[model samples]
Target: MNRNTPTSSKPVIAIREADYGRLTALAQVTIDKDLAVGDELMAELERATVIVGEVAACRTIQMGSTTTYKTGTSEPRTVTLVYPGEADIEANRISVLTPIGVALLGLSKGQSISWIARDGTTHTLKVVSVGK
Candidate 1:
């Protein structure tokens, strides 16, 4: 889907089944520390289409995938989606437990998602590219 495509109430997202269990567990673990983002991640996972195997050829974003994305009209940023323990903002490694990370997960290149921040601000994030 390109920028011109009309995004739905929530765009379709696909997640590898192999990552589902671990992701869900991660969300659960973070609930106490960050209820809002954790809940958001769980909700996103609940709505995702789980694929059983590899989708290496697809441009879908997954854990460990390096992606370039832009929020609203901001400049594009490259980040590696990683687990909380591995997250390092200075290195551009984002934790799936964060709002932007949850928003990026499962999205394919060219697709965009609107998410609410902890401070109650809404933002649109578009995936420019995805690389494993």
Candidate 2:
């Protein structure tokens, strides 16, 4: 996905059947209230171009030239998002299973969010752009 353009309009979120089921099960087990919002979120995830979660949460992510500027860092880094099986950090390409990968899922361009790193430090990032 291209991470240069702004995502102003809300696009559809997509999710795999298995992933949807897993999320639903998790919500059901944890929350007592009716998971209507969670259900709707899953439906929306089906059409999502971006997703947000931990590294282990994503099944796949689009690969392309995208730049990321860390929340408190000045230098912007470019990286490619590859499928889980093809991710290589040394090449500046990462799998969707990585920390930054999952946190970026389902997010639109211009949206800023935070996620905890493996070291327990909070990391914030912004969606600079997204493309399929």
Candidate 3:
């Protein structure tokens, strides 16, 4: 059963069942810590449309997806959404444990959303494209 839900009032987001396992572990560990965005990450996960990996469809922003997005009016930038251990700001790889990274997951091309930074600053990002 592909859990591709259309969150009509909110932007549509989807996730693969395989990644769900690890993401849940991360959330379970982080949510109990102070100053972690784990709660937010958990919320995003809860709303995701879960599907089997093989037939999860195309263009869904799962881990390892190289995505191009714009933050508010800033110039567009591209980054590969990765796990915390693989994140390197200079290399443009973002960790899914981060606020923005968590927000970007399960999103498709042309979707937009506002995410809160660790410092409490809010930023709006629009996904321009998704690439494998």
Candidate 4:
């Protein structure tokens, strides 16, 4: 991704009222501080384009080359951000609250972004495409 690339000018996609409500509830339950990044993220969730992918309908999503999260206390493992409710990562389906998921939200096909991981690592990811 080019550092000089221009930010998107397309109108933000609007999420459904039910989806927005669900995201807001999740944020309130999981987020720590009222001013934390999660707070900001939840506020923007209403404008995100929800993507979903499965084995039958794969959508490539860039993920941290080296990063992991707690999953049954076995070992930290890398995670891939795919559409919500799909793409199992470490046996746990990732939610958009995840760093990569949040970053990828609302992006169109071929759009690339350099995002900071939860562990402070930076990664470049492109939206290859989205599917049902």
For TM-score, the strongest prediction is 3
lDDT by residue for model 4 (3-121), tens: 21133532343343334566667666656554244753564564455544333223323221122332233454344544445656675445566665665544444555555566767
> Which has the higher lDDT value, candidate number 1 or candidate number 2?
1
Residue by residue across 10-129, what tens digits does model 2's lDDT show? 333334444555544543442345423333333334445433453422333233324453466656565676555677889977654445664555555566655555565767776665
Rank candidates, lDDT, best first: 1, 3, 2, 4
Q: State model 3's lDDT.
A: 0.81
Residue-level lDDT of model 3, residues 18-100, one tens digit each, is 89889988987887674366776777788888888554635878888899999977999999999999999999999998888
Off by over 4 Å in 4: 1-14, 33-37, 46-87
Clashing pairs in 3: none
lDDT, candidates in the order shown: 0.82, 0.48, 0.81, 0.47
Strongest candidate by lDDT: 1
What's model 4's lDDT at 111? 56
Q: Which runs in model 1 stand beyond 4 Å of their true positions? A: 1-8, 32-34, 56-58
Between the candidate structures 1 and 3, which one is better when assessed by TM-score?
3
- TM-score of the candidate numbered 1? 0.87
The whole-model C-alpha lDDT of candidate 1 against the native structure comes to 0.82
